[model samples]
Target: MLNLETLSMDQYSFVANAFSFGLAVMASTTIFLWLMRSSVAPAYRMAVTITGLVTAIAAYHYLQIMLSWEHAVSIETGEVVATGEPFNRAYRYVDWLLTVPLLLIELILVMKLSQQETINKSLKLGGAAALMIVLGYPGEVAETIGTRMIFWILSMIPFLYIVYQLVIGLKESVDKQPENVKGLMHIAAYLVVASWAFYPLVYLLPLAGVTGGSAIVAVETGYTIADIVAKAVFGLFIFTIAVRKSEAEAGASGTSASKKA
Candidate 1:
C-alpha cells in the first residue's frame, strides 16, 4: 500500500538535512561544553560530563541515521534503491537505550541527592527508562498495526511510571533545591514530558492508515526534532542548573569559612 516512489526528493532531502543539522549541533555542543570543564565546580563536573556524553552519543547516531537514510533512498528521485542494506532506524533506539538512563542519572546527580536516595531513585527510574525503550522497539519494527499497538501500550506503562516518579517521587528532592535553580529543574522535568510526548503521536500516525513515504518522512523528521529538544536543549538546562547549584554551594562555603575565621 505504501509506494516509495510517491516520496519526493524534497522529503528525502528534508530528513537528510535534519539529520545533518542534528549531528552538527549535538557534536558541536559536546565539544563546546566539554571544554568548559574549568568553569563549573568540581561538584558538578560529572553532570556536565554526562550532558556532553548524551549529545556525543546522539551525534554519533545521527551520523549513522543520516547515512542510513541516504542509502535507503536514492537522493535523486526518492525511491528505495537496492543498497543491499536496511535503513538503520535502530540507530535511534540504540541511542535512546544508552542515553535515556544517563539523562535520568544526570538529573539525579545534579540534584545532589543523598547516596542512598540517589542509588534508589536511579535504579527505579533508570530501570523504567531502559524497559520503556526495549518495549518500544518491538512495536517500532512491527509489521502489523495491531502488533505495534500492543507493544506501544506495554511501553506506555513504564512511560507513565516515569512521569509519576518525576512529578511525585522526586518532589521532595526538588523542593530541597536552591531557589535559583528550582524553576529550571521543573522546566527540565516538563521538557522531558513535552518532547517525549511527540514520539507516540508520530508513532500513532501509521495506525491511522498513514503509511508510506509520507509516514516515513513524518516519523523520521518528527523524531529528529524531538531528539534535538530532548537531548541537546535538555542538556543545556541541566548545565545551567548544575552551574547555579555549584555556585550557590561555593558561596555558602565561603561564607561559612569566613565565619570560622
Candidate 2:
C-alpha cells in the first residue's frame, strides 16, 4: 500500500476533482481524435489514429486511478480520513510506460520521413521514452531522498536524450515540414519538452520540502495537468500535421471531406 495521509477537506477535494477532470478530458479527447481520423488522408491516418490511441490508453488509466482514489479515502463528518485503502500510484507509471513511447511514435509517423529515417528515429526516441519512464519509477517509489535523487539522476540520462532529439536531432525534420505546419511542429516539440519537464519536478517535490499531503496533491495534480497537454493537446498537433501533410502531398485524401464533415 502507498503512504496516503489525511488530507484537509480542501486537499482531498482538490485531488479528487483533478482526477475526475482528467478522466473526462481524456475520455472526450479519445473520442474526438478517433472520430476525426477518417477526415485525414490514408497515409496520415495512422498518425492521427495513434494520437487517439494515446488518449484512449490515458483515459482507461485515469479510470483505474479514479476508482482507486475514490476507494482510498473519504470525509467522516467533515474530517478527511483514510478508509484503510491506499491509492495505487503505480497506475500512473503503468500509464506512462505504455503511452509515452506511442506519443513519440505518433509524432514521428506523422512527419512522413523516409522509411529508413522513420524507423531509426522511431526506435531511438520510442526506446528512450520507455527507458526514461522505467528508470524514473524507481525514484518515484523510493522512500529516502538519497535513493530518489540517485534514480532521478539516472532517469535524466534518457530525458536529456529526448530533449536532444527534440531540439537538435529532430530540427531538420521539423524544418522540412510543410510551411503551413512548420510553426506548429516547433510548438509541438517545445510543448513536449516543457510539459514533460513537469513530471521530474513533481517527482522531486518532497526533496523541495513539499512533503506529506501537499506533496501528494502536487504530484497527482501536476501529473494530470501535464498528461492533458502532452497527450490531448499534443494529439491535436499530430492531427494537424497529418492533415497538412496530406493536403501537401499528391492524391491526398479527405481535404473536402474534412471541410464538409
| TM-score for all models, in order of appearance | 0.93, 0.93
Best by lDDT: 2
lDDT (tens digit, per residue) of candidate 1 on 1-261: 234455677776777898999999999989977998556778789989999999999999999988877776564443444455567788989999999999988889889888999899999999999999999999989988899999999999999999988888888899999999999999999898899889878778888888767887888788988999998999999999987887777778986435434
Residue 41's C-alpha lDDT in candidate 1?
Answer: 77
lDDT of 2: 0.87
| lDDT (10s digit) by residue, model 2, range 1-261 | 345654677888888899989989988988998898877778888888889999998999999999998888777887777788878889999999999999999989988899999999999999999999999998888878999999999999999999999999999998888898999899999999999998888888778877677777878898999999999999988888887776666434466545544
What TM-score would candidate 1 get against the native? 0.93
Q: What TM-score does model 2 achieve against the real structure? A: 0.93
Q: Which pairs clash in the backbone of model 2?
A: none
lDDT of each model, Cα atoms only?
0.85, 0.87
Clash tally, candidates in order: 0, 0
